[model samples]
Target: MSAVLSPGMGAIEQAALRSDRFRLEREGDWKRLDAIVTRIEKGRAKGLPDEDLLALPGLYRAVASSLSIARETSLDAATLAYLEALVQRAWFQVYGPRSSLGEWLAGFIGGGWSAAVRAIWIDLLVALAVMVAGTVVGWLLVAHDVEWYQALVPGGLGETRVPGASAAVLRETLFGHTEEQGMSVFAAYLFSHNAQIAILAFALGFAFGLPSLMLLVQNTATLGALLWLFADKGLLIDLCGWLSVHGTTELFAILLAGAAGLHIGRGIAFPGDRPVLESAALAGRHAATVMAGVVLMLVIAGLLEGFARQLIDQTAGRFIVGGFMLAFWLAYFFAYRGRRQTAGGHFA
Candidate 1:
């Protein structure tokens, strides 16, 4: 052998001998060691920021057991050092602060919703126009149908149709219907229902929230048609008074739901810079937050729809209740924005 080879032979031989001995020592506990390695590898692959810290207990226990086994077999120091390195590498991976799959998914959902909102503002304007047109068409159609029926059916059936009921009477009926339930019951029902609507709004993004939008448009149109009919009959003031009790709040909740649907739809339609799938995922997160706000609105709306509207028959009382609800919504959303700005400015 060369002079260089001869000089390193003693150290190299010692390491080789230790490695062989360690292998023999590990054989009895090979399965446990394999399991530990597998877990460490899996944690590393997950790329979650705190995975290493979370895996430390398991890794340490495995190392301690292996060390005990090595000691029992009188394994060399070099072999112990090699094993320590392996464990350390695993430790580094598990405790690192890399983002996980879940965080990525959350980002996608959030981004998608924001994009959708921007896309749908135009559609909302179109929908509002459709609502106005539909209202006029529906009222006219209902009126014509009523007239035709009266001409054909004659007497007693006409009484049931009642073409000229007072707006005050309708307002009283609206209030009476609302009073059938208590505040707590109304609140709970609204909360649950609103949650359902919001979730549905988000989930319906599967169909691109199209069905949800259609539902909103149709609803708005129906309301407008009814209002127009009442107005034409010279009961507009009375009808407005009756509707002020609950319609204002309830209608606003529906509008929010429509906005949420629009948000989801736009996300699917226009993912922007990212891949469509990723963008949609990001939008979903933001949509969910907005939907949460929507639920709060709906809960308040339900209170107006049920207890308050029913309990207060007077038009002035209805307006007062409705005005308060509107103010609360504005304060929570618009007012909260200012607070955020102030905090951000201070931090800056």
Candidate 2:
């Protein structure tokens, strides 16, 4: 004869039966997902067929649904635990990052940085205009009043680079004697100074980019003041040649930094339909990538400033080097088409 059961015991028995039935119905898909995920995790998925690889996502979603159902229906403890584990493992294989560090770096250099730069084209244009205007403003200020030179040029250059220095003195400063041993130190110092400026420009982007634009204007204005001083002595072309060696790279880096800041500022200032914080975060990610590349540009500029500018004394040679670099950077950022493209069919 069958034994009698209490009410609680009867309920438990019915639940266990339902859990067993549920597992049986879905266990095949669960097992398939588990096998695929396992193969990938174990580095044995290279030979996995296209069909199986394609099926993996579908299988994962089905198992995830099963897990959710089990929890809601109060399935047996063992079944619940098993589905939880399976779903978690499948989630990683289905959605986790698959690239190694080397792969990531290669992609970033090949296309990611350039794509990010293109994404903020509007901001870049604004920054370029601001820089050009600033330089002109600087020249006009010094041209109108010679006394403005002292205020615009930094104090370190006052001894030799004042407004009224003789042509001999100004020429000597350009083709000055150099200590080979001090070249590295000088390069390091330039790098440090440029890096500081770049960092400040990027960091100040949160205040709607006003501060970043001001910083750019301030830096370029100094450049304008120096240009006027050289132009006054009829050495405008000579000064251009002298600065071309490294100024191309250095100025480009600053331009990008200012643009990155402006991108963030624009995001916050005009968030559109998205929440302000979310829009800022998206812009920040793009800006951060651009800034990372800017650091590399600054390092190159430093090397050119410290060594190439010193070693290449001829005006023509300096322009050649500088022009080649500028061409290279332009092609790399805007011309190269890589394997990965964003939604708009541009490299990313």
Q: Over the stretch 137-164, how does candidate 2's per-residue lDDT look in tens digits?
A: 9999999998988887776454777877
TM-score of 1: 0.53
Q: Which pairs, if any, clash in model 2? A: none
State candidate 2's TM-score: 0.77
Q: Which candidate is the best by TM-score?
A: 2
In model 2, how large is the Cα lDDT of residue 146? Answer: 87
Query: What are the TM-scores, per candidate, against the unseen true structure?
Result: 0.53, 0.77
lDDT of 1 by residue, 193-228 (tens): 545644565466556667766655445444555565
Full-model lDDT, candidate 2? 0.84
- Compute the lDDT of residue 36 as modeled in candidate 2: 85
lDDT of each: 0.55, 0.84
Off by over 4 Å in 1: 1-137, 143-172, 175-202, 338-348
